[model samples]
Target: MRQPSSSAPPPAESLDAVQAALGAEHAAIWVYGLVSAFLPEQFEAPVGEGTTAHRARRDTTERLLADAGQTPRPPEPAYVAPQPVTDQASALAVLVVAESDTAVAWRAVLERTDDKALRTSALEALTGAAVRATRWRRAAGETPAARAFPGQPA
Candidate 1:
């Protein structure tokens, strides 16, 4: 990634971390779309909300990368789900996995950056994903829906 023209450009490692977060955002958006068909009409609102949230985050991440003089990585044509989403339960499970992945990526960005603004952004992203993951887990009837230490490796 090219350094920003500003005198206080973010470190390359931080930029790379942000890029990874951006990629996670892309995957989350894709997963949201993919799960729509498998979900019931009762899930329509939540699915739309999830798609909107991920799209907004993706746009913000792309802008951040552009401002840092890095070309944002494009999303893959498709993403493989953790398991077959043949029903609502499996679909919710995949959503939980997507949000967990997003949280992990944002946490990596937080660890790699000393930039206060970036840290704040990353923290918000991580928290949002963690909450979403919890919601999905609950919807899937998983016990202990809330993660005690979100973004930490199990």
Candidate 2:
């Protein structure tokens, strides 16, 4: 993500939105870790990929906030999954929910920011989360795996 051009701080609304996105990224990393045990060995690659992607996004968000002189919010100790994740199917379902939440958060950032670089970064984050959610939905045998309007409320 690009740093703010001037020393002046980012807009308060934009900072808050980015902080929310950071929180979502934190929750996503936690979800990926929690689902590892429930997923089969064949699913290792995607799980690892998701974890890495979320971590990178999280780091970038933190740097952006810090550069703007705002302290980024820390992750919660634990997050409650939308559904219980006892088996492979439930695990995938929860992963879909996590990714969807991140997409929504990133989309909010896009709406709040007018900064060109910030908007570009937010769009990429939203798109990535949407794609990840679709993958999880497909793995769980969801009939319509792709959302018609990702980042929009269902």
Candidate 2's residue-wise lDDT over 28-117, tens digit each? Answer: 999999999999999999999999999999999999998888898999987898888899989998999899999999999989988889
lDDT of 1 by residue, 1-154 (tens): 5544655757899999989989999999999988999998988998898899899989999998888778999998877887988988889989999999999999999999999988998999999999989988988889899999899866
**How far is 19's C-alpha from truth in model 2 (Å)?**
0.4
Each model's number of backbone clashes? Answer: 0, 0
Give per-model TM-scores.
0.93, 0.94
Residue 24, candidate 1: Cα error in Å is 0.6
> What lDDT would candidate 2 get against the real structure?
0.93
Which candidate leads the pack in TM-score? Answer: 2
133: Cα error in model 2, Å: 0.5
Task: Show pairs that collide, candidate 2.
Answer: none
| Candidate 2 residue spans exceeding 4 A from truth | 1-8
Regions of candidate 1 where Cα sits further than 4 Å from its true position: 1-7
